[model samples]
Target: MLVRKMDSEVLVLATDNRGKIVELTDLLKPYHLRVLSTKDLLLPDPEETGSTFIANAKIKALTAAQASGIPAMADDSGFSVAALEAAPGIYSARWAGPQKDFNLAMQLVHYKMIISKSDDTQAWFTCALALAWPDGYCESVEGYVYGRVVWPPRGDNGFGYDSMFVPDGKNMETFGECNINRKKLISHRADAFSRLVNRCFKGRNFDGKRLLSFRQK
Candidate 1:
């Protein structure tokens, strides 16, 4: 059954990435959630020792929920290149080093691709979203968007590998070239968020602007 309305309830986002915070905040705006980030609460990020995206997301969410005594949401996302055997999958951020220099990371990808001499430029982005309650209950979902990699990473609109990725259906515009709203419409994160909303936020009534109430499922 669908849970009761979460009107004005607090939801802590278990991430410190400014880009992610902006995107997620925008996606969650309709729910009227009083969103806070781990940075805001002065909570230290838990070590993400999981092997997969979902596992990592769950770890972060559960850790934040436990620490804050409130519901928490987290997402672990990355870029994977088929030619590289999906390398840098879970270590996408690590590839950027401590400075979080994604430009260096993107350059590394291009360098690896060149040295490997792989004709295939196919790649994809993966995102896993997890929501956890203070009681230890948690749920997760994964989403993906496939496309090819582009060199000389174009545009500056997005953070991370957005410049190096051109999602399917987008004429040649890299994610960095597209605006946030346009990117949100078809991003891997958006896909995951949509699934989450369908599963958890289902039965909620929306009269265009405001959410009325949640219907019993």
Candidate 2:
């Protein structure tokens, strides 16, 4: 019958951070999907009780989905320290302190790593993304990017740990220095969101396959 159906997947950005919404909106915009901001709905940030990234993301996504009955999305991301044996792995965001001073946080890490440079100072940024559909079909995806830390807060492009992280091949620039599109290409959040959006928007399943090769399931 050549029947066509409209995509009802309204991606709800579950965050009060306008910068994050803008970054994520640009990433998801290619799908031509409707993206809603948390501020638009006056949704209060939910208490994050989950101990892990996926758990936290799921909590936010589920909360939004329950409230709006739309497919909602959330990201829980953080830094992990190799020298500390990953002590601050899940505590990255909280480590920013009352002032949200990532420079201080970077200093603390730099000191620790300098003393224990023998260890794999190799750190990774991890993002766990959750998608909550109105029909109760929820899915979670995770992405990780390995990199080493830089000092003195190089640039002003990105927020949080991006200032300290020099991703895999890049030499001089921190993630904060890289443009939004460049950051999106090799970011943890992008990896997870790529999986999620491909599945939901394109009716494809990525599984463990490359994003470009996503096939209809």
Candidate 3:
């Protein structure tokens, strides 16, 4: 009896960010699972009280799973600058303010660096993903991609600080200069997704062994 799985694979994407939704939808499409965004379900956004990306991601994922009675996925991601001592780490989104005007945020970052007379433009983008089940089981993975800050922000391909970020080893192309496909190949989110796919999505198990093979590496 080749009993097939019905609508048992519906997963709620616990995010309202269209960029993340698009990226995740493409990444998860191969699984043939129904992925719904928070907007699609009209779910109230949860307040993030966590001090770290991983913690925030878990909070969102758990909230979605509990509220929707379905498996939920969420990611917390941001840019951290070495010169500014990671000032905008968890506050990346907040820095953009309610209007989500990243141009203002990028200017702030640039101003901080210039005022501090800091030459260390080194920075990195990090992403933490959490997958939660309705039964209260959850798994998480994090990833980072190093880069340098750029001024006179270029391109308009990506949203947020993309225009001001110059990723390493990519011909000095900022994320905004690269298309979605190019960005996916060298993004912190992609790194996190790779580990997540292996750790949890591979078996779709909440009790699976915690895989740290791709963390902070």
Model 2 lDDT tens row, 20-88: 787789877656667897778888888889989999998888888788877688888888867778746
Candidate 2 at 185: error in angstroms?
0.7
Instruction: Report the error of model 2 at residue 182, Å.
Output: 1.1
Q: Compared with the true structure, what per-residue lDDT tens digits does model 3 show for residues 125-203?
A: 9999998877777888898989999989999988878898998883888998888998887889999998888665554
Q: Stretches of candidate 1 above 4 Å error?
A: 1-8, 205-217
- TM-scores for every predicted model: 0.92, 0.83, 0.89
Per candidate, the number of residue pairs that clash is 0, 1, 0
- Ordered from best to worst lDDT, the candidate numbers read 1, 3, 2
lDDT, candidate 1, at 50: 99
**C-alpha lDDT (0 to 100) for residue 64 of candidate 2:** 87
Best by lDDT: 1
lDDT of each: 0.89, 0.74, 0.84
User: Cα lDDT for residue 86, model 1?
Assistant: 98
User: Which ten contiguous residues of candidate 1 have the minimum total lDDT?
Assistant: 205-214
Model 1, position 72: C-alpha lDDT score: 92
